[model samples]
Target: MLWPYQVKTVPSLPEDAVRLDVVEQRIVPPEEDVVLIAHRQRIVRGLRALFAAGVAALGLLVTIQVVMIVEDRSRVQPGLVMMAIFWLVALVVGYDAAKGMLKPLPRGKWSELVAVPASGLATLGCRIQWPDGRWSDALLSKVDPALAANVFGTQRLWIVGEAFRGATTFAGVPGHAVLGRVRFN
Candidate 1:
């Protein structure tokens, strides 16, 4: 018989699935709510201010390119390149200002979890099967590089897990998103 080196679990077929009560509370967290946990909160006012500034800056760049085209057509190439680069920078900044993309894991008490990890490469994900036959996929995280390597290594290892979920939502909803913390037993 071939040795099994990986475990993959995807909850398919309604009969095999259980309710996501304790974690998602019968509903998967909204994708937007997940973003709140995953990104820094960007106030709308700041984004509006940035939007105004970006428009003016872009206008200036365009005006300079027009001047170059009239003065020396060939010299306009460098101006065009600069405008492209500036436009890219503006796009990234605008997106970040409008919505956060990088945020640390929120501070909270870790809750003990009984879960069977989805095994593979140095990746963060698992599917936990409840006693009632319900299974749910959770994303895993660990701050320590050493510990994460051990648990995420290629070799098989028994895993004990903890979870830190977002306790609040942007839209004032009661439910939250899950971020699993893991350790090898």
Candidate 2:
């Protein structure tokens, strides 16, 4: 049954009472979808800005280097440092861009959806879908399990589920992404 109260959770929806089919799951009062969209937009904007800044900084560094080379003959110390910093920043930004490109963006009103199959596994850990939704990474854990038996026998499935719910990890998680449900395959 659809509840009017639930419909209000999704910010994208109009204030009028409405029922939404979120992904494949049918939520009674639709779960709040506000933060996901806002967070996703924020991420996209941040990445775009970082990319622009990185490019601009790199260009400035190059210009300074060129002028220094032409005028002094010997390399300028400060210019070299600045250029190095610029390159480092650019490298970081480029990596971020790659990750953003590879990861799938949030789909529909349910931005937290992730499908991780059993086939993708790791030696030291397990494999999980990346938040951007493009790739999987090894899950480093305290107790490494070789077979599914261990996962199921110990009820560690919950842990696995929790991990799946969380966004593809870089280092840790943020408050907004903390809410997620795990699906077993």
Candidate 3:
């Protein structure tokens, strides 16, 4: 994708920052988050119901479409094949969305992390951080240059996304996109 003129590396301030609580890198199952276990389970139960409703609606649509295409034909039609592919993709998405319905639990140890600031490397656009000795990354937005320059160094950033929505990633986060972005913190 091409960025328009004036694409920037840093953002403006507190207004643009996403306040992320420093969480421990541990494999926390939905049940482990004791505080919200019941809430999360309830959501999952509701999503399961939604999944059933979606399947019913999509199934009906697919059935009618298939009948219309094959009613007077000796062989399957292009529309039928297209509908097949569409349902296939939909099922895949539905499966993944189900998995994402549950939040992810990150597991591991965090190293000095100081090296992340020292060595600047970009992966698929997001900055990579060194966890202990291995490389790791997250769905993070661009950090303000001023914040990064301070002693804390990139303690915060801004990102737009939905948590527990992606099949595998848990969160479907977008890239670090911004406009002129020179407002006060």
Candidate 1, which segments miss by more than 4 Å at Cα?
A: 1-42, 77-80, 85-135, 138-185
For all candidates, what are the clash counts?
1, 3, 0
lDDT of 3 by residue, 1-185 (tens): 13358766765656767888997755333224443345446667887787777677668767776786678556556665676567667867877746644443233211122213333222122233333344443332233333233313444322212112121222111121111111111
Number of the top lDDT candidate:
1
lDDT of 2 by residue, 147-180 (tens): 2333323322222113343444221112232222
The lDDT for every candidate, in the order shown, is: 0.44, 0.43, 0.40
Please give each candidate's TM-score: 0.32, 0.38, 0.36
lDDT (Cα, tens digit) per residue for candidate 1, span 1-185:
11358887766756766776564444323343454343223434556577767777777777888887889887777756688578768767767644422333333322223454465433445554444566565544432333334334432222222222332212112132222233222
Q: Which candidate is the best by TM-score?
A: 2
Model 2 misplacement above 4 A = 1-35, 75-82, 85-98, 101-103, 106-185
Error (Å) of candidate 1 at residue 16 is 62
Ranking by lDDT: 1, 2, 3
